[model samples]
Target: MSAAALVVVKCGGNPAVDADAICADVADLVRAGRSVLLVHGGSGAIADLADRLGVPHRTLVAPDGVTSRYTDPATMEVVTLALAGGVKPRLVAGLSRLGVPAVGLTGLDGGMLRARRKSAVRAVVNGRTTLVRDNLSGRLGRVRTALPQTLLCRGFVPVVSPPAIDEHDQPVNVDADRVAAALAAALGASQLVLLTGASGVLADPADEGSLLRTYEVPATGAPGRFAGGGMALKLVAAREALTGGVGSVRIADGRVSEPVRRALNGAGTVVRLSDMIPSLKGA
Candidate 1:
C-alpha cells in the first residue's frame, strides 16, 4: 500500500462470497498503515430474516432490466434488523480476530450517509411500465467523512453499511456498491475495490476465464458490453467513483486469500478513464 493511499473496499453480501478473506485482507492493510473503510450489505441475510418473520421479499424490475429490492415499510424494517443485527457483527468479529480494531457502523449512525428518498419508482411489470409507490429506496447524497476519518485517526477500521438516513430522517435502503463509490469519492480515495463472487467482469457470465482485464469506462453512462444483472449497477458505481476522481476502480473475487492485495495489484477488471477502449486481456 502506498503511504498516502486511502481505499474503500466493498464486500459483497452474497452468501457464496467469503467475507472473512476480505476482512483478513483489510486487517493486513490496516496493519501496514493504510486507511481503509469497508462497506457491505446484507440482502441475502435480509431475505432469510424476512422469510422467518413472514415478510414477503419482492424485487422490482426496471425498464432497463435492472432488478432492485422492493423496500416497503415492512421490508425496510427487516433490512434494518438483519443488516445491523446479523451481518455487521460477524464482520466486526472476523476483523477483530485478525487483529484489526473494527468498528461497525450503519449509515443511520451519526448521519454518516445522508440520502434523498425516492417517493416512487417506475418498474416494468408484465412488460409494461408501472409505478410502485411508497418505495423506501434512496439515492445517496452527502457522506459525513468525519466519522470514518475520526475512526481512522483512532486506529480503527470502519466497517460501514447501508440504510442511509434520508432528508426526512427515515432509513432507506441504498446500494452498497454505490455507497462505497460515494464514500470513496468523499474521501478522495486512491482506489475503490469492489469484491464479488466472480473473478472479474466476464465477457460471458458463465465463463470465468473470459475476464475483461481492463475496461475504459466513461465518466458517465454504462458501456454496452458490460451491462447485466448486478454487474450493471457495479458499472454505474465505477463511473461515479472514477468521475469523482478516484484513481482507479476494480472488481475482483472475494473468495481468495489476500483478495484486497490481488485487486490492488490488478487481478481483476480494472476500470479507468484514460483507457480509450475496453481490453479483454487475461489477468
Candidate 2:
C-alpha cells in the first residue's frame, strides 16, 4: 500500500492566486501521490465586492486592541459567493483539466469547519468601550475529520475554506489559516503550506536578506498573534497547526509557478519548532 500523506494548502485570496496555476499544481502533486487539501481565502474579492455593493467591510479591534477585518453576516455572504461560487469551481475545473478529481466544500457542508459565533466582540464606541454583538466572525474550533478522511481514502482531494460551523450550527467567519490548522490536525498532515503574494515570511518585508527560510514559530498567547498585520495571524495559525501534530507548516509565494511543488521541495520559509527545523543551508 502506498503511504498517504496529507498536506493542507491555503491559497491566499490575494490578487496573486491564479486559479489555473493553483489547480494545475495541485493536480501535479496528486499525480505524484500526495493527498492535498486546499483551503483558500478571498479577501481581495471580498474587498472588491464590498466596494461594488457599497457595504463597508469593517476591521475590528480586538480586546487587546489589535486591528483586523471582522466579517459580519454580510461579509460572510460575500465569502460564500467568492469561495464557493467563484474560487472553488475555478480550482475544481483547473484540477479537472489536469485529470485530477477534486471535491469543493464549505464549512456549512457536513460540518466541515466548525466554530462558535463570536458576535459579542469588543469594539470602541465613539472613544468609549462597547461590546459589539451579532458579529459574524467565529473562532475555528473543530473540523469534521470524516469528510476529508473519506475523500482522501478514496484518492480524491478536498478543496475547502472558512465560515466554519459552530456548536450552535451558525455559519461563522474564520481565518483561512485557522481552518487549515484544524484540517491539518484532523488529517494528520505533516505539512501545511500557506501560499501568499509576498515572499514567504520575511523578517523585513522590504529587504531580501530578511527572508526566513527555516524559523521557529515564536511562542504566542492567542490564535492570531505575531509581530505585524496578517503575518501575526498567520504565525498564530502556524503555531496551532504545529502544536496539533502537523510536522511542519510552510509559507511561500503563491504567484510563483508550481507553488505546491516548490514549497514541498524547499522553496519557501518553513515555520516549525526549533527541534523540527532542518539545516536548510544547501536547500
Candidate 3:
C-alpha cells in the first residue's frame, strides 16, 4: 500500500471514546479502498478488571502531566487480560460484523512493537516527585511495519495494542498513542488520526468550547501549548510522526459518527510542520 492510501489511527481508552464508532469508521475507510491500521488502548477496562481481581490499580502522573497506568507486576497481568481478552475481541468482532477483515495483534506478536523497559520512572506521587524503581513500563523503540503492511495489502485491517515485548522478552505496558505514531512513521503513512473523548486539544481542558482547531508542533521537539493529560503524550506522538515525514496529523473526537471521514475532512485539530512555534518544554 502506498503511503498516501495508508492511515494510522489510535483509539483512546477513555470510556467516552466509543470503540463501536471507531470500528465502524475504520470499516468505512477500508471499504473506501484506504489502508487502515487501528491501534487501541483499554485503560478503563484495565481498571475495572483490576478491581475485580483485587489488584491495586494506580495511575501515575509524570512530571510532564502525562498520565499512565502504574503497572506493577499484578497490574501488568490485568492490563494484558483487559487489552487482549476484553477490549480487542469486541473491536475485532465489530469490524467483522461490518465485513472488514480485521486481524487483532499485540506488540508481543511477531515483535511488531519493541521497546526498552524503563527500570525506573520519575513521577509525582503524594504531591512529591519520586523515582519509582520497579516500574514495568516501556518506551517505544522499533515498530515492525512489514507485518501490518502485508495484512493491509491482503485487504485486512491490522488492529494493534500493548503490552509490547521488551528486550528481555517480557511484556511491558506502552502508551497506545505513541505506538500508533511509531507505526505511522515506520509505514510512511500519509495521515495519522488520533480519536479521543474531547473534540480536540482545548485551550482550557475544563472548557469544552475552547477547542484549538489547529496546533503547530515546535520545530525543536519541545512542548507547545495544550500539553496536558493524555493530550501531552499525544502531542509528543504527533511530533514523532510529523518529524518522521507523515503528511498530516489530526486529533479529533471519537464520539461522533463517521469520525475517520470527519477527521480527514478537517473537523479537528490539524497539525502541520509549517505551523511550528517556539515554546519552553513543559514539565
RMSD of 3: 2.9
Question: Per model, how many backbone clashes are there?
Answer: 0, 3, 2
What range of 10 consecutive residues in model 3 has the weakest lDDT sum?
274-283
Model 3 spans with C-alpha error above 4 angstroms: 220-222, 273-283
lDDT tens string, model 2, 199-256? 7776666764666776665455533222356766777788888888988888888888
- Residues 1-283, candidate 1: write the lDDT tens digits: 2324788999998887788888888988888888898999877899899999999998887775556889989999999898888999999999989888989999999999999998789888988999998899998999998888888778888889888999999899998999999989988888999998888788888988778887766554444455567877787788889888898899999878889999999798887663344455453
**By TM-score, how accurate is candidate 2?**
0.88
Please give each candidate's TM-score: 0.93, 0.88, 0.94
- Per residue, candidate 3 scores C-alpha lDDT tens digits across 87-121 of 99999999999999899999999999999999889
* Residues forming the 10-long window of minimal summed lDDT in candidate 2: 274-283
Candidate 1: segments with Cα more than 4 A from true spot: 1-3, 274-283
Which numbered prediction scores highest in TM-score against the true structure?
3
Give RMSD to native, each candidate: 2.2, 3.6, 2.9
For model 1, the local distance difference test gives 0.85
Cα lDDT, all candidates:
0.85, 0.76, 0.86
Model 2 residue 160 lDDT score: 88
Clashing pairs in 3: 63-283, 64-283
Candidate 3 is scored at a TM of 0.94
